[model samples]
Target: MATQPVTTRIVLASRPTGKPVAANFRLEQETVRDIGEGEVLLQILYLSLDPYMRGRMDDAKSYAKSVEIDGVMEGGTVARVVGSRNAAFKPGDIVLSHSGWQSYAISDGSALRKLDPDAAPITTALGILGMTGFTAYAGLRNIGKPKAGETLVVAAASGAVGSAVGQIARIFGARVVGIAGGAEKCDYASREFGFDAVIDHRSSDFASRLEAACPNGIDVYFENVGGHVWNAVFPLLNDFARVPVCGLIAHYNEEPSISEGHNQLPTVMRGILRRSLTIRGFIQREFVDQRPDFYREAAQWIAEGRLKYREDIVDGLENAPEAFMGLLEGKNFGKLIVRIAQ
Candidate 1:
């Protein structure tokens, strides 16, 4: 079959000093090149927008290299294989690939995983059954270590990772308390996501409210937002509590050297020493060897209706920058995704 000649992509137009603005991204169209011997042509369907991508915008030392100026912004994408020069994939095969911010991409197939659209919605390969879900499982299981009857608190309660952390903690018989930004999200956390208690972090009485909700003291705190939310959770932690330091969306857009408020290191250390808490920071790739187990268990829970996920999908690659900016402001309600094509 003949392939289309052109592809559309969003590239990094410029680096941002703080929060990323629309000017930082540029959308352009270019001709698609023929696939090489072991490569496949992918038609991107969904693009996953995660908080960690914010760090990649800056040219600094991190676990991964920063996206260079004028380069295509990086992300996980679910695509349909429209053409293949390889034996492993054929036309119409949906696969998970790091296809970045383009409508069509060429891949060598080594880093791509074929998907069964019949098994689950193809988009899920970028969400619940993919990297995001695995991140939640691996972090919580290895660090949070929720036990039966224990209490687990998670922020960004409606996001991909936080939602998964809450549900998985419940499966292990922990009482889950979710902290979200607004009343609607708080309701969704408690009513839809099965959280034992939901607190609106935007409330004027946020710290007091969180204290009231977590009467038994927090045993496991899945740290997603690390600003005011962290300040609130710190004092509520019980002795021997476990905290898995995940994404810190609250400070993602801020300049690395800027101080948001008065230093609280002494207070944090005091709590750590007094309560003997265990805090561990992690990146999802640390648990790649456990992907098989995570996928097996997470898929089962999703299939059995024990795990529920919500996706806030925006249309078009042009809207990605604005949608991503909203993500930092807690404007998104759930797992954020971009539907680039049908």
Candidate 2:
């Protein structure tokens, strides 16, 4: 007799009205059904928690569909195949799939990518060597177009995406300036990541400090956190500057009442016109064709000691909701991943 398998998962209990709370998520468990043809049962090992997931939580329409109520919160995972009906996959095969916030899932082998633990850490498939790194590579290379001797500014310097963007820009011989929220993050961005300069965005003199840091003006501004960071960088954009609009995390949880007061779109337009700036917004998937190149180059950079990465792992599936809440509050450091199972 085949033994039944059970899986633990988290679902979106309710759409958050503001910053998400613990009540917004619910923990549940279900027995895994027998795998049918071309199906593989994945036992998730790691779950990635990204800032962008916050945008997906909203009920309003956006780039992706909202996670329906009672639906498993969507996310990427690194998992091991424990049961397989697919000819291409075997038991114990480590693979990458969109398993969301679950301890186990059934994948039909439609869009599964096999991962080799020998080449890089399996966790890299969830972060640096995966979506987070690719996001930095595709966005900066295609849009930012940074050049040697130019200055590049990135908000949230210690984060997964921002950190990658700055490090890659340095490889291009660009002066990298990172803006982080506190003294510790600023230190990490400078000492560990090799950023040319670090600015504490929480300081009262943040704008002037940023100006001093970029004496040549900013040739590329990676726009991850909008709002005040945008305001500070707007005037310092060198002529024909490129701004890659990535995650606008600063306004992610903005209350409409307070958010409605920002009438700076006109000012932003005026700056764009006067400076002839080249602003481009990009989603990581748009550069899917370049994934191979991304993998090769990024891996080489890591091997050559030009690239580095960090992870903040939280243990257990039940804690994903609390950790995710902390992610939005900027309580997490480095690439946030939940260790669901061994």
Candidate 3:
């Protein structure tokens, strides 16, 4: 009889207080469990590192359950079916699964979405053609509702969701201004992503440049990095402007505080009331019904050269924790992916 394969996995060692570190994750090896009648054993190929995973590390309540101590670090992954007891999948089939930070995972074949390499690169199943792209599409369609000749601003313009938001808004005939951290990223957002204008948020005159870029008051704002960027954009929003709150990467590391001068709720509420603005926060899963529409349109746009995406891949599962930490600090150029297997 053949010996069962040994699987390498990373589990949550301790919850992070502010920023996650290597000590928060523990690596271990265990035998791959035998599949049941309806289960499939998956060999993870690519692991996606996203900002939302940071929120899950805390013990606080959120839209999703936290990653319990000693459990696998939660993430989305693309994998290959290595062994299957289910008829829906075969040994060589590639699939997208939420198998987290592990080399092997067992699934009941229910949550697996089979992937076809011929349609698009398998890694895209975890990136542009997947969650991030869907996030951009959903936010715009439901809340941002950008219209022709209107101006839209999105921060982190060279990133997965921001890049998509910019390009998609342009396709909808809206003037798009993007904000990125550095000169290189700003250049890419303008030249590669085709944003009408790109501002380097690190510039000393970032607010001035952003103001100049949007001569017409911003009609829609895709809020990604919500610290200083929000401060610059708030005053420039047109009356009845729509704001889709996507992420707050800048504030994720902040500890709970109500210190004087740190509270902006009063100021923000006053602005909202005066401007009659519409600000809505949402999770991608809430628009799961529109995923099919997103997949079809985004795929067509990619094939037609209207949409583009980039990825920054790090090799080895052991590097995932370090890569993820870098992601929160804006260290990655594009979508951060960990190549766990060939």
Please give the lDDT score for candidate 3: 0.93
Question: What is the TM-score (0 to 1) of candidate 1?
Answer: 0.96
> With candidate 1 superimposed using the best TM-score fit, by how many Å does residue 53's alpha carbon deviate from the native?
0.6
What C-alpha lDDT, on a 0 to 100 scale, does residue 215 get in candidate 2? 93
Model 2 lDDT per residue over 1-342, tens place: 278789998999988887888898999989988888889999999999988888888888677898999999999999999988899999999999999999999999888999999999999998999999999999889999899999999998999999999999999889999999999999998999999999998999999999999999999999989978888999999999999988888778776764677588898899899999998888899899999999999999999999999999999999998898888777899999999898
Model 3: how far residue 74 lies from native, Å: 0.6
- What local lDDT does model 1 show for residue 79? 91
Q: What is candidate 3's lDDT per residue for 28-59, written digit by digit as tens?
A: 99998788898999999999999999999999
**Residue pairs of candidate 1 with colliding backbone atoms:** none
Q: Among all windows of ten consecutive residues in candidate 2, which has the lowest summed lDDT?
A: 253-262
RMSD for all candidates, in order, please.
Answer: 1.5, 1.1, 1.3
**Index of the highest-lDDT prediction:** 3
Q: Measure candidate 3: CA RMSD.
A: 1.3
Clashes of each: 0, 0, 0
Candidate 3 is scored at a TM of 0.98
